[model samples]
Target: MAAPKEIPLDEIQWHDPFEIQRIGGLHSNTVLFYFASSPFFDGTSNNAIVYNQAVHNENMNHLIHTREAFEGRLREMTGLEFMVAQEPAESGPGMGTGVWVIHKQTRRKREPKDEIIVHAAYYLVGDHIYMAPSFSDIVNHTMITITEKLSKCFAIADKARTWSPSTGHGYNTASATTSAKAHALESKGTTPMPNTQESSTSEAKKPTRSAVDSRLAEHSFMIHMQYGGEYMDENPITGKPGEFHLSSTGRKDKMPTLALPSLNTTMVSSSLTQPDKKDAKAGEKTPKTPTGMSKIKRKKSKAGATPTSA
Candidate 1:
């Protein structure tokens, strides 16, 4: 595959790779939009993007210290001092609304020859307060072109969606008119209601065994073992096997009495009662031939005399 060539700044539509993401909030919703080819793109980088975050709240601090916030972040990253200058100007719809223009310049600690300048605009459109900040090495005309495109893209949508006349922070009658129109359309059943009950039921029907098994045992089953002559079922909860014991009624036996075979005891008792084999053999008397005579000759003489004596 071939690499994608960079687009020239003037010829660029300034809208490629523009993406938006919803930033969650407890009290208000915020939408952030990024223009990929903005002056903020430092060339030869991935995810080199810049943002304009639109906060949907009336009392938001949109104009205050926006320059300082950008400088503080740059100072933290580069460890250098930044000089800031602010200018007030009219914005939106033939310069009817007011806005703050912030300009900041700084140099990195290691790069003595290099300088960075950031330009940010803070303005409100309808119910949303927008903070559009960008930093780059581009000329002022390019910066203005990029900011204008971004402002126009979000301003129209913000006026249509989040702005309401009931908010009482009206920037223009068009915002109020759009708010009323959206409310009337909604009341006329243009939007569908959420199926909250069905969603909750489905969520509840999800198996809770995985949660229980994580805390308890992953695999639950019966464990049976034979101890002595009685079969014992192990308790899965306490993981302890049962022993032979009486029932709570005291009359009935819960388990049979455990008994060992008597072969060992019988062998021990018989050994204690029987006579010693060595002592019995020593007590037995045995007839012996004279040391000088042969046993064979004595046996022959006895057999020959036995016939005459009989």
Candidate 2:
């Protein structure tokens, strides 16, 4: 389509004269109007469009003022020419009925073709005018919504996590207590309480086999240290009994004793008969046998000599 002429804002004149031709008791307003499927169409059978003339006039004045203000803003900034064009209805429902405010800048080109750039858009659905969302606005809104949902999911997962080292995971004391109580009530025979049973079992298992063996070894060592020398007298190599008795007998047999010499009866009688030796001279003495001689010499003398005359 050919682009609209770019007119300077100062050269344009403002007018408010509105005229409409009535046909068959029906009239249509064309100031700031666009062609679209609306309930307020000119030749429609629905006559509620002009039910209140005062309200219709007020809506037209408001649209006129809004367009004037928007154009004044563009003129103040870059003095560029702008126009509001009707947007075509899309294929889907509720996709049409909006106006686009397009900015027109003359581009120097070899051919006479102008490009129209849309600065902003407004939707006049009923009486309300809504500004269409920009691309950045839509992206920011979607990101914020997703972040909120993700945060809620993380919070739920954190609450569900209950694993720990000491108590393990999902340990419930109340459930255990309830089961114990139920078991106690259901039994017909005499049985111990849960606490008593636990205590008895723990006490019964206090001394393990290894601990008992260690204690027994310590007691035997103490007894050996106290009475080992007196009672433990068995020979280690021969396994004989009487080690202490044989040791005592050997000690007694190895003891030393004093000895005396033996004398015959004849000698004793001679000595008794010659008792008055005071008159005998010291040198004139009979030959006497040495009494210090060993028993072997005395025995030989006895055997060699014949019986002496009495």
Candidate 3:
């Protein structure tokens, strides 16, 4: 590629469509061709069609013409010397073709050490020219996106929150209420009332206890009725004041008594006279016999003096 020719600010002529086309030649892919063909393009003024065509094309002559027209328009309208410079591509793909439109602080001779302040930058890649976004624009867009996402999150959290006077804050109240209702319905469907016949049958099937005296009274009444002694005044054997007794014929049919073993009198006396081991351990003392005549001697003396005593 040929080196870019620097056009002096004083030498740049006023933008003229016919002159630019006559010098640079027109092509289908050129911004100038589109501008010439567009009905809205006036010979002296920049219009939307011409500007958009410049942005969409990548021709080198188109870039020069666009810069010239911009500078002329700014000089005519704002009286500012806004210069445009084509910079060499940097070290990466699609970085080769870039144009930096700059605004200078002073109109003196251009110095190599002077700081160049960029007003805007345009990048050419493949068949199009794109304006680079400023830092402020990127920051503003990121802040807006974060704000929108936070708002959505807050809305969802608010909807999930549940509040009650008794339970305080919780989540998913609707599901809890649904589960309670389901449990109530299930209990209602499963439980039934007890029937009268069923209750009566159950009571009849259960066993009950009776007093011993009441059972004996019932048996005595049955015995009296079977022996034809229902109106008897007293029991003949025990002399008890009762009408329940067996007749003579029923007494003959009674069962024999069971034999009981007899207890030994000597064994009973020996057991009663013996001192218990528990009483001996408790420190109990046995009473001693009085110092006097024996009972036998006393009885003999009483017998011998029976008549002498007056």
Q: Of the candidates shown, which would achieve the greatest lDDT relative to the real structure?
A: 3
lDDT of 1 at 84: 27
Clashing pairs in 3: 89-96
Worst 10 residues of 2 by lDDT: 19-28
Model 1 residue 185 distance off true place after TM-score fit, in angstroms: 60
Local distance difference test values of all predictions, in order: 0.41, 0.46, 0.49
**10: Cα error in model 1, Å:** 3.9
Candidate with more favorable, higher lDDT: 1 or 2: 2
Model 2 lDDT per residue over 1-310, tens place:
9999985332332322222221111112232233112222233211122223324686533433344543333333322232444534553678864433322232222334444344444444333234456677779889999999999988876654454433444533667769988986695557654687888799897985445665676788889899788754433334356652233323344567769567577666666666356777787775364465454353334666786655
Q: Please provide, for model 3 over 146-259, each residue's C-alpha lDDT reduced to its tens digit, 9 standing for 90 to 100.
A: 999999999988876755434556676777869988975664546685696989799788653333444566787788789964464443444356854443434455698999
Ranking by lDDT: 3, 2, 1
Cα RMSD (Å) between model 2 and the true structure?
26.3
Q: How many clashes (backbone atoms < 3 Å, residues ≥3 apart in a chain or on different chains) does model 3 have?
A: 1
Runs in model 3 lying further than 4 Å from the true structure: 1-112, 172-310
Candidate 2: regions farther than 4 A off:
1-82, 87-110, 166-310
Question: What clash pairs does model 2 have?
Answer: none
Clashing pairs in 1: none
